[model samples]
Target: MITDPEIDGDWDTAQGAESPERLTPRERARGGPGVRPWLWALGGLVVASAVWAGGLYAFGDRLSEPTLSYRPSKNLCEDFKARTLSGLTGDLHKQRPMNQESDHPAVYGAVCRLNNVEGMPDFVVAAQVDLHKKTDPSTEFDVPPLADIATIGDVRAEAVSDLGERAVVLTSFGGTEQKLKVLDGGAVFTVQVSVSTYNEKNGRPATDATAVQAAMIEDMRALMAALRK
Candidate 1:
């Protein structure tokens, strides 16, 4: 009853039988037949999670904001029709089809310029549509220092009420321009009606600022209503 040396070899030889390469932390865990498969699976899951987190950190804002597509009716002039003051009215002229262009990330905008036939003060209407972005339009609602916050035509708006029918204006784009911004259906609609009554060219009064402002408000109101339809 004798035991062979090869069969009952040294424990060091048995341990070194697998491989001589240096094993990494993961490789060490995958060394033997007795190694649990769940551990390998868990390691894989951890790697996947790290990749996903990195992606989110890199592109969070862009992924959240949706891209806007263009449509023919979304053109600036066509969507916002040309209008003139009722009594002071002459001929209403609409410029070329205002193309919808990207204003900012996830925001598309366009403006339609309208000129008076009688050489009166001109008007411009602009629209900005947010392409399903979660951005709040109220950020653009900031008015001038003394501007009044009032409700016009069932919508709460910030305006220069003291202008008293001369102009319904607000501060925007770093408070450099005076305009109207209406937030509706993931879009911001803006209107700019000239407040000048005296023609700069002839130095004579042409269109009434008060009348032009009133007409601008009504025209904007009508456009907003149309968007709802």
Candidate 2:
């Protein structure tokens, strides 16, 4: 049979050889095989991987997206009044209930600040609720820098729990302050409660970090329990 000039052997001899084992080196070297079977297999595997990636890119939204819950309150100040302190009426004590609305209806936030009467301590509670339409399962909730992971019941937080129950605290965004966060449904609620005392002699704000933490924890726990109800 005719064979290509570049090939080392005749096409007939290469094709009709008894077996690969019997073929001479020259015969085995030519009829210039189009491509090896392993090469074909590798190409097929690559094609399959590409198809899988394309499919994922095209239809990923329909797969694995988490459905979140949304809850809105009309009167956040009245709701948090009793939970904050006894005989503390938002109306009676210069209560400032702040409300902010976003373009996305799924996102909602509210804050209620109860100021102290010059000598006593102050209390502020804020809540943010986000109902995400989609969620990344591979994502990680990274703890804030220089913070330790802590737990209150089943809730996890980044906090410092070195002090006794009288003062369990966590540092928050605004420097060293006590804070806590809890995840419910598809919503995350973060609460910060801090106490700052004036140093009569030093003329600067003085704080017992551990004591503040303990008080903040109690307030945070109370606020969380109230929100859940």
Candidate 3:
């Protein structure tokens, strides 16, 4: 077979792992027979490896990539339905499922707040959903209040208004907040989970806010778990 010399220029790998034979090209060329099988095998392996690597690079997007360990739970919104909208305008809290691939939609009257470990101020999340209206589903373009609680454009920040009966009523979430991101409209509504830690001093969370962040995440998880129903 005709093999390219460039692919496996050095046949060192072809030698057994614990091989003690030190054969050089000069010596082998002078010797009777040459290491053809090993050389060809190594060359084939190299070519195969190159092709595999090239395919991966070209199709990286289609490949499965590593992601966060936590996935969307089917029982994420159960509690919100049972206990959230109970007192507010009769049991009106809307319930929905959360997906791992994209952001969840807003449910009217579904409200939640989380406290950071740092004993900072609490963060509030208000769901401004249109359970009554023919609203679009998906997290892509979130409307104010329903899917978004916090609004900020450069040097401005505040909450939205005119939310329906199932709206969230909380202070601020934390520096870390969830956004509206809908892949395909599934009649799915968006819910804006507010995020903010106590600013006792400044409105934003402090630098050493890991504790607060952990608490917030914990609360969010708990709330989501309760919404499964």
Candidate 4:
């Protein structure tokens, strides 16, 4: 019988070869060549996690903390003179102004309400100041006017330029009510003026939306200037 030397050699090698060695419990637990890829993957994940944690610890505050340009007012009524409104409405009367202030680690807030006076056309002006101590107010600065739109239908919003980092005017109640909001750095300023539609004593139209918006913007600028650090 003629036999191929290559085939005979393969059969002889296969018959002479012993069974593969079995791994002990300790050796199996320690891992084998098959487990090397998984060990490398685990080591890579550990290194990545350490890097991320170290980065957060080193620069988290610098990246997250906001830089505030303005300071909080102790009394918003004193800071907000409402001079433009006084001119438009009339002389300031003896009505007591409402003022509130709060100071905390995260934020500082102040609110003022100047009620309607006898000599002036029936109008109320409210001013609010928010100085964010920890975070940037810009993200949520435009939210109030938007909320006003959702709450009070028929409201119109217009963006005002050259006032601050950003400014918006919200008009409602047939131009009788106007709200001006300005955001600069971490500070937020809001001025809202509500006047009667008609003057009963003078028998004249009271609300001039354009004039009110102008006055509101001017006064808001003044208020922002007054509260700056």
The top-ranked prediction according to TM-score is 4
Better of 1 and 3 by TM-score: 1
Alpha-carbon lDDT, every model: 0.48, 0.46, 0.35, 0.76
Superposed Cα deviation of residue 125, candidate 3 (Å): 6.4
lDDT order of candidates, top first:
4, 1, 2, 3
lDDT of 4 at 142: 62
Model 2: which residue pairs collide? 167-214, 168-214
- lDDT of each residue in 140-202, candidate 1, tens digit only: 444433432231112233554432122335533222233565544445566754433324333
For residues 1-229, what per-residue lDDT tens digits would candidate 2 score against the true structure?
A: 9986785555555455346676667757753243357876898999999999999987675445554443454555554543433222122245445544343543455555554333454444444433334553223323442333332222233433432222223464443445655454444545554444323222223445454445444555555455553
lDDT of 3 at 73: 33
Model 4 residue pairs with clashes: none
Write down the lDDT that model 1 would get.
0.48
Candidates' TM-scores? 0.44, 0.51, 0.25, 0.68
Evaluate model 4: give its lDDT.
0.76
Writing each residue's lDDT as its tens digit, candidate 3 over 110-173 gives 2322222234433333322222112333232334444233354222133223322122222233
lDDT of 4 by residue, 89-206 (tens): 6643347888898888888999998866645636778899888887667767766555676756667779999988998988885777788888887888889887766343343235
Give stretches of model 1 more than 4 Å off.
1-73, 84-89, 94-100, 103-105, 117-132, 143-168, 171-178, 199-205
Alpha-carbon RMSD of each model:
12.2, 8.9, 15.9, 9.4
